[model samples]
Target: MSKNIDVLIIGAGAAGLICAITAAKRGRKTLIIDHANKAGKKILMSGGGRCNFTNYFIEYERYLSLNKHFFKSALARYTQWDFIALVEKHGIPYHEKTLGQLFCNNKSKDILNMLLNECKSLGVEILLNTKVNKIRKNEIEKGFNTKTAIGDIKCQSLVIATGALSIPSMGATGFGYEVARQFNLKVTETKAGLVPFIMPKKWLHHFGDLAGTSVNSQVSCNKHQFKESILITHKGLSGPAILQASSYWSTGDYIEIDLLPEKNAENWLKQMKIDKGDTLLSNILSLVLTKKFASKIVSLWFHNKPMKQLSEEDIQYIAEKLKCWKVWPEKTEGYKTAEVTVGGVDTHAISSKTMEVKSVPGLFFIGEVLDVTGHLGGFNFQWAWASGFVCGEVA
Candidate 1:
């Protein structure tokens, strides 16, 4: 006999777990399942294993969506404070690392365990390593029927919490988007978000040796800008600034970087010329940037000569390049290394209030699977908590 469920949620990640817990607490028979052997793999691996759970600042402005205002209602309803309270209630020791990002003081497991504990306490059934082979509308029951690896089940409400394509090792998949298509819900074009930029071979040939060096600067692309440390990698540039700009970048786009964000480069260079005209330009740059990086910058962008040798025009040119250095990245590192997917199920087809499909009565999509994506530093996790919480109340 087919099992009957009031709610059946796919992908027992952050959203699925919370949604199941809420539904079960509401006296709804809930079952949450995932194809992965373990639930909350992403949560366990986030923030270098400590898990940046949420941010102090969570506004709709931090996110990117086709429907910019769609995320406002849910986020306001289940604010970051609510999630913070949940964390504190579980006695998970955490600290603010930087920019109001809250990370577990111990390990990411603390966060996962908290969510799992909530599920257990609410009597929500969880199944790991279970796959859904197919799903179809159940007209007789006025619900949906799902064929799983173990057995068939019917549910009045179905939630697609399967996250978007990001860390494949974490079991991220396009299954959520496929399900949206199956339901005839419009899905937006998706891309890698908060990802690293891959430099062209010709550019890497000279700068690859400075792979571990980092520069604090402001990176801008497509009118979006972020001030963060930019790390030089063997493959290309990968750092908070580059990753933030990657979300707004596209193929063949040029990224403008302010290498010396704090100093007035022109005035600094001009003063240095009068003060120490005998020093080499590379040597002068070493006062601010790493000696090796300064040398590389001089070699790549300007002629490395004594300060006295550089004319006024040369100083102006060098200053302009220092503050407004431009380079075209070949492309992003793609989904495998990306922190989040840029888009998924279009929010226009989803109800911002309930996270339910506008046309499909019992279908819902939440978390990263939706087109909504947040900036780096824990906003994505907040989105998961908020969207999941709101969807849970109804689904």
Candidate 2:
């Protein structure tokens, strides 16, 4: 005998769980399936376990999409304030981090618990460790027929919230992209966003040992810019500013890092030369930037010359390097460590209002599966909430 559900949600991450709760609250029989035994594994590990759940800055410009306006409807329908209200209702204490990112004061488990509790109150059925064998549509009625390791199930609506390929350790896969292709939807060029850059081996020899060293700098790619902490890793760079710029960066792209963001390089150097005329260049830079970076820049620009012996040309060159140090990254680390995939199901094929396929009735795409992908911090989770909320309301 075939089991029946009003809506069958694939994947048990943020989007699927939220959609299930919302649908069940409206008296729909909802079943969410995931191969993993536990739900929200990604959520459990996000934001250092406390979870950066949403961002205060959620303008469309913060997202990268094939059709940028496609996210407007859902985001407008379910704003960050709506999620804040739910958090307040659950009594989950949260606080805003820098740049309007909101994180739980406790742990990420509190978030998963709240979502699961909502599902239970709404009577949503959750199936775990379930392998889906197949998914097909009924020719006559246009309903979905899905066969899982447990059994076969039929549904009037099928919501694909499988997310994207990011943290493979959390079971992220290409299933969502595969499903989109199956329905004849155009999938855009996908790449790892919010991931680290891999410096060339030669430069790694020069910079990799500087791991754990961080600097406050202005990072720029093309015309986009971010003023945040930049960290040096064993392999390359990883930090708020670098991750933010990585989303807009591509192969062979030159990234400009302003080593001294607080003051004009030339003016600061002139002041330093006048005030601390006897101070070594390396020693003066050590006070403002990481000691290792200070040493490295001194090595590159000063040619082992003494600070007192510095020429006008040398001073000007150092100023330029300090103000605008440019490096063309060899390549990004890719989706294996990416926080979100850059592209997915084309927005042109999906309705901006309901997130439903224009041609394929009873089918929906939300969260990281759709064309929209948000910037670092909590914007991606906000998209998950917004898109899931809309799909749940209409599905």
Candidate 3:
């Protein structure tokens, strides 16, 4: 059995759903296919089920792409406000979380339902639990023939929005990259982003005791810094600050953490020595960090010394260490626990405006499948909406 579609979208994800709705609204016969039983699995689980649909403050700087300016065109064309308006049209109640992140007041399912409803209203067809067995592009006809478990699908415009390899349990796969490769498109090296860092055995041994402890800190790596709460885990470190820094972190890279971002450690130490010389170093540190974490640090660094026992030189050294607490991550938690994928289909090979392959006219790639990755906030979702919207307009 064969069916012809004006636009065939692989992967009924955030990007694919938006693309289908946008194109179908333009009177195109759009069909979205996914291997999963349901669409928008990621959306259903994002932001602890509330779904950080988009960020209030979105800019090109917030995204990481081989071509840094590639996202500007699409993002500007379909701004966050546009999606916000769509949410309002659906009458979904949402609130802004910290750092301009927006989440639904009820559940993530509301966002998914809204997108599905939009697609339904536009007469978009979605095929769930349909796995694509093969895809071939016809040179003469200038179209694509995709064989799936259900049947053969032919389309004038083919879009690969299969997403990236993140959260495999939720059905994330590298099918998008495979499709890009089949079309001779360049795919950059891919890695996990917004993931937790796994500390080396030695470092883990020292800090592992502080598992479940969280502190407000400024964590920096590769010139990128995030000031948020860092959580100490049994495996290594996690939380907003660590997760943000993990995007910029490479293996063997040292991340510096300002344990007390509010205070100049050296100055504060000097003042403390003058005023409360009898106090133990751990006790003073406890004011800023958790008691267990403070005690562990003092035990390892200062040999459990009292403030009065330390000389000026020792005090300065201690203060400097506190200001620049460095930890070398052995590796990231990988795609299994990553919030997104860092690298993907090379943007240089695709048109930034339409997300269409420059060489393959009717083929397009968008969302996490592309090299564009956003920061820890809702920027990723914004990229999905923007790129999908742009591609739908043209493809």
Candidate 4:
């Protein structure tokens, strides 16, 4: 005989787990399952294991989507304040790290435990290491018939919270996109977001030895910019600023980096020439940047000329190069190191209020499976929570 459930949520990640708890609280017979050995793998590994649960300043503007306003409804309904309340209620100690990002004071496991406890208290059963092979729409039962390893299960509402194609080593797959196609939903172009950039060999050859060096810089591309510390990796650049700018970069685009974000590098260089400080250009730059990096810049660009030898026009050109140094990324490091996928099931095919398929009844999609992708920080988790909350209420 087939098992009957009111709600069947696929993938026991952040979105699925929260949805299951919400449905069970509504007196719905809910069962959440995942192919992995444990639930909330991403959550446990997020924020360097501290888990940035949500941002203090949650706004729809911080998110990117085919339809920008598609995320506003659900986010407005289940705001970050709502999630923070739940954390406080559960006695999970958390603190804001930076940029309004809230991370657990202890570890990410605390957040996972809290979600699991909520599910347990609500009587929601979570099945681990369970792979779902097939799903068939059931017009007769007005629901879905899903084929799992154990047996066939019938559910009134089916939710696809399977996430997207990032972190493949963690078992990330395009299964969610497959499901959307099975239902004939339009899926937008998918790409890696919030990822590092691998510069060309020529560029790396100039600064490859500077690997492990971190400098606070402003990276910009396509009218978008981020000011943060960028780390010089062996292959290219990797850091919060680079990751943020990578989201807006396309294949053939060039990114600009400001070596000095706080002050005007060009004006400082001009002052050095006017004052006739007998200091080498590199040595003068060393006051702001590292001595080695300053030496490298001088060697590559101007050949270590002294302030007395360089004219005001020469210094101006050098300053312009430092302020607007252009870089063409060979390519993104891809989904392996990416924090999130850029696009998925097109938001136009989804109802923003309920996260349900507009043409298909009793079927819903939420979290990273959808086209909405947030900027770095706690915005992504907030999206998962908001979308999952609204969908659970209806599903």
Candidate 5:
């Protein structure tokens, strides 16, 4: 048998659910299909289960895109306030985390429940465990037909909200990119974002033992800088600061980290030389950071030299090391632990205002499937909400 709908949304994710609900509410016959048995699997695991749904301070600057300004239209059309209003309407209690990021007061389930409840209220049809086997465009009707395990489904407007390949264990795949390619849409190269870094073998050999030891530091790569906690690991490094910097860091690019971010290393070292002149460099580092981390760093750099016996040049070198410790990571942990994918369908071929394909009308793309990616702290979720809402309005 064949099913027909006004709009068929692929992938019952955060974006797909939102788009489906919005379209159905507008009296459009909307159907959402997903291979996964359940919806919002990613949402259930986000923010450690609390789900950071959106940010209070949403700006275009937080997003990273090749065009850099392609997200402005949809984001402006459906702002963070609009999502906040939806949350309020659902009566989901939420609180603002640091830096204007918002999280559910209860659990991630609250956000998913809100979305699912809205979908039900709008009478949107949702099919779970529905695997799509093939997709072909109906040239006569200028529509797309999707052959699924269940049956064939046709729609005037088809939205690909399958998202990017990030958390594969949660059923992530490149089906969206594949579908785009089938339609001759240009897809940019993809990489992992918001992932951990893997230091060189030499650095790992020395610092691997300091796994789980974390400290606050300022991390910089490219033009991006973030002040957050960095945790050393057996593999290399992972933490908020490292993850934030990883988005901007590419292979072969060196990352600069200020270990003692708040202190002037030169001045502090000089003061320590006067106050505890006989103290060993390892002892001084131990006082500032954890003993294990200090010992490893000092042993590697200063050879555990006594502060009183060290020459001025040696002290200066130590100061420079503390002030600007450049970490030339061997590579990132890749998509295995990445929170989001960094690239997708090119923006040049799509309408920024409607998220519709410029060359292929009746086709739309939304959410993380597009090249538009946001930084950490709920920015991506806001993008999901904004893009889905706007696409639904126009789909």
Candidate 6:
């Protein structure tokens, strides 16, 4: 019931699969194990099944980590262009969606199949539906004995690519964090990232009426601003802009949203008063924003007044409100609805260049298990590829 491998990768997710491919290609005896029935469950469902595999524009600042610069080395060594080339090599057609986010032309399964094919070509072993019960590192022999439901696995190097607690229904768990703690590694405060915000009851009542309505907006939080469409949800605010800002948001913090990012509201209002004095303020707003939202704004702020009735002060006030509408979020939707986990095993204790535990040789952590969380888009997947590739080179 005991098997030995040169490299043992836990969790046959994005990182583990890539790591196995890399190691096996290098002639190492690699085996990737996962408890899931099949590999790449997340990848199959990501980006509405298209899978945003990597971003066209990648930078070090796009990732959040305790050590901001830790990802630079791996990312640089395994660039997005490299992955893109591989995808092209496989003849899996892909296209850029927006803001440099690339997605498969068909389905996420294409990306998964590409990785699987590469691993197969290299003779990598993938054991699915196998749960690891215990992992004990042998200090004297510099190896690991991992007990699983299938059997006992012994390996010279162990790679923990088990992702953090993001989507519990997808079988996501804190197994990676538990493994890190078993080895006496430091883990930072964890929270949901790339999640939608739930507004206060009063605010929800007013905005919930506009649920399903989308508006072009510029949302800012924690000094980060995103210009995209914000959707009004029954629970609260969502859409790309709101979701991007949510990564930087905490409870009690207010988010500033520019409803009219493309226009000078004050100047436009003054001109409207001169040209169409008979028009209602709500009518003017309806031209740019949704009629329901405009009517609500007029009822709440202007008392449904006509354009001619507003004084210079009122004009200025309305303009300022449109430019900087602030709203406080009660809380996030939590990990159940989050795209990724914000914090994880502290990067300071790991070698950024090798993705190896500095104090514990042959032990490695990669992908979402690390504290590094990428911004919305394909950045997270890119991190998985880069970190896994780097670790496979040495591990």
TM-scores of the candidates are 0.97, 0.96, 0.97, 0.97, 0.95, 0.98
List runs of model 6 lying over 4 Å from the truth: none
lDDT of 4 by residue, 56-78 (tens): 99977789998989999999999
**How many pairs of residues collide in each model?**
0, 0, 0, 0, 0, 0
- lDDT tens per residue, model 5, 238-344: 89899889888888999998899988888888888889988889999888789988988887877676777777788789889987898899998887889999989
Q: Select the stronger candidate by TM-score from 2 and 6.
A: 6
**Candidate 3, 1-395: lDDT as tens digits:** 89999999999999999999999988999999999999999999999999999999997788998898999999999999999999999999999989899999999999999999999889999999999999999788889999999999999999999999999998898898988898888899999999998888998888888889999999999999888999999999999999999988888789999998888888898888788889888998898888998999888888566777878898889888988998889999999999999999999999999999999989999999999999988999999999999999989
The whole-model lDDT of each prediction reads 0.92, 0.88, 0.92, 0.91, 0.89, 0.93
Q: What lDDT does candidate 6 reach at residue 79?
A: 96
Shift in Å, residue 57, candidate 3 = 1.0
- In terms of lDDT, model 3 sits at 0.92
The order by descending lDDT is 6, 3, 1, 4, 5, 2
The weakest ten consecutive residues by lDDT in model 2 span: 300-309
Give lDDT for model 2: 0.88
Which RMSD values do the candidates have, in order?
1.3, 1.5, 1.3, 1.3, 1.8, 1.1
Better of 3 and 5 by lDDT: 3
Better of 5 and 6 by TM-score: 6
Clashing pairs in 5: none
lDDT, residue 272, candidate 2:
77
